[model samples]
Target: YTSALHFLNTKIGKGQIFLKFDTVEHDAEKRLLAYVYMKNKTFINAHLLKHGLAQVDTTYPCKHLAKFTNLWKAARTNRNDAEKE
Candidate 1:
């Protein structure tokens, strides 16, 4: 089990992982989604569903979704959109 855990930890520890989530529902599910981070761009998709990991709200937590979202809203979007036009 330790080896598997080690493998999991190493697999998802290499990317700019982010977690934005909502209120946890089930205890078991919460245990799974409580910790989520990326080890790499490809692997670690499952770590976000495991214990001792980075847990984030998968959905908007309130009525104002944007305000509670991790959605990227930087000026870079404006520049890119302008460049396209």
Candidate 2:
């Protein structure tokens, strides 16, 4: 969580941020869950997954589920390989 927060901080002021909503806009408690993108079209969700800083939540279906799951798998594999070294 801290790592994700720090990385997001670095993105601050780089450009305008945009949110991409899926089927559900928010959870039961009114917390938002959306894909964040930068003005230049940088995908923050994939970035976090690629860096092993975020986990893929498969509880709900989303458009990027397959892509996110793939990225998360690759990141986990990379981390495991690095640890084996």
Candidate 3:
């Protein structure tokens, strides 16, 4: 969690960010769940998944859920392969 927070802080440091909300605005806990994007058009969500800093949540359907899931799977595979080396 600390690593993820640090990664996010570095990515979001003093830079303009954007959020895109899906059909729904908030989650069950009233937390604002949206797709985060960096100024240079970098998809933060995908990056987090690719780096194994975050897990893909499929509970709520979203356009990028599939892509995020694939990235997460690839990250896991890469990590496992590295561990076997």
TM-score of each: 0.27, 0.90, 0.94
Where is model 3 more than 4 Å wrong at Cα? none
Writing each residue's lDDT as its tens digit, candidate 2 over 17-85 gives: 999999988877899999999988999999999999999987666999999999999999999999999
* Over 4 Å off, model 2: none
> Which scores better on TM-score, 1 or 3?
3
* All-Cα superposition RMSD per candidate: 11.3, 1.4, 0.9
| Whole-model lDDT values for every prediction | 0.41, 0.90, 0.90
lDDT of 1 by residue, 21-64 (tens): 43553354345332234534432433322332322354523332
Backbone clashes under 3 angstroms, per model: 16, 0, 0
Quote the lDDT for 73 in model 1. Answer: 35
Q: Per-residue lDDT of 11-67 in model 3, one digit per residue for the tens? A: 888889999998877889999889999989999999999999999887787888779
How close to the true structure is residue 5 of candidate 1, measured as C-alpha lDDT? 63
Model 2, position 8: C-alpha lDDT score: 84
